[model samples]
Target: MSERREHAEPFPDGSHGDLRADCERCFALCCVAPAFAASADFAIDKPAGQACPNLRQDFRCGIHRDLRKRGFSGCTVFDCFGAGQKVSQVTFGGQDWRRAPRTAKQMFEVFAVMRQLHELLWYLSEALTLQPARPLHGELRLALDEIERLTLDSPGALLGLNLAAHRQGVSDLLLRVSELVRAEVRGSKKDRKKDRRGADLIGADLRGADLRGANLRGAYLIGADLRGADLRLADLIGADFRNADLRGADLTGSIFLIQSQLDAAKGDAGTRLPPSLTHPAHWSPGDRKVGPVVGA
Candidate 1:
């Protein structure tokens, strides 16, 4: 498990405080519940329900400070949206899988469901904060309340949920929120028509592009050169930013830009971000000179 900052202030229904990962209150559920294949992100193959060799008995990562060097970088970018602690402390009442061996399988299954629900809460909380999305606040709040209620469901009830259908319903509402927020940007009709939603831009050069109010939802931006790009007010929900160069990019006020997406990208001090997100620790402190833009 990775260390995360604690958010003390509460949001609607007092659910915002626990939207960020808090590994201390968790039971190392992330480390044991998910299966990992040997790849650039992970150094070894790990099976579901089995503890990682690097997981300490205290539920902390053994290579917490050196996960990148240890080839476990994937672990660093993972954000459970505080679902681990919620399941461990609230749903299960602090009952750990180890102490109750019979509950291990069910606990892991519920963790999966709880993680998705918590992620929806994170996005909804952010949506409620956007002034441009004020028109949808009532809808967003109602959705948030419903999801928060679902989070407290018993493990059996959670596992019985049709997560895909539920997620689609929330995603539809979020899409409306994104449109409401992004529409505040005064972009030309031509620019507005340049919808990059789910576009395949892998390794494409996008340096210094004017992408304000662009729709990049679910776009494959892996290794793209986005340095100095203006991404303000862009809809970045589910965007794949793995290794994307975001140095000098202005993403201020970008909608649905989550910390995990930024964690997977390469950025620097010059990369402007929304107030809700912080610079990833892995980002460089200084900018580096690069060649001219390839495909603007």
Candidate 2:
């Protein structure tokens, strides 16, 4: 179990505190906290709070090397946002749930809450770095501090946290940041149509589209032809990117896009990502080669 979270993008300049998953300090909370169905994502069904069948006694995945081959492809894309380590080491004081069965339920519940808080931290950290969002830096800093504080609270305090309320407040600020960033995009009148927020564009033919600063929030872009599309500064929060062809697409400076969104899409070396994100290792050259741009 490597101490790396798939969704935890590093701070661009290494100035901010770490949010990356440190599995070395974790007790495999992700393998036990969340429930999984015997579907395309998992080989077998496991209820919440139950240890995964592949979990070893030492809190490591028995099939970590070949998880995708064994029908756990979804696990490869999942990120706990450093919640596992925080729960195991800090919150529980290095006490393993197996050694303290009485605290297992509360531990799992708190782990879930911590994961949410950590996720908010991940996005907030990125939002604070955006040049267009400089005006909201103070608000972002406050939100980050509050969320980080919550993550350090006792298990009971975490369980009692109003997660929904906090998320809503942060979300409103993020929306404002998106609007400011997108408004700065200079494009022709035809390019203005690319602002398709919450559009049902599943499998749309958007090849070579100049979608700079588009409001693509919550858009269903599964299997969309995004080859070489310019998505810089686009608000991609909640956008469905499964099976989307991102080969050669420029996502530089995109806002609120998470690693899970990239993991679900097809991209290659030609895909340009933000400074904080690393390209998915699973993507291969054969998945989606760079093709000719229809309108460049």
Which candidate's TM-score is highest? 1
List TM-score per model, in order: 0.92, 0.89
- How would you encode candidate 1's per-residue C-alpha lDDT over 111-144 as one tens digit per residue? 9999999999988998887777888899999999
Instruction: Provide backbone clash counts, one per model.
Output: 0, 1
Lowest lDDT block of 10, candidate 2 = 287-296
Q: Where does candidate 2 clash, by residue pair?
A: 3-23
Each model's lDDT comes to 0.85, 0.81
Q: Which candidate's lDDT is highest?
A: 1
Quote the lDDT for 287 in model 2.
Answer: 35
Candidate 2 residue lDDT tens string, 1-296: 33233433356577444467778788888888889999876889999999998899998899898887888877877777778888999999999899999999999999898988988898888888777789999999999998888888999999999999998998898888888777777466865877788999899998888888888989999989999998887889989998899988988778888777888788888887775666677776543322222222
Model 1 clash count equals 0
| Residue pairs clashing, model 1 | none
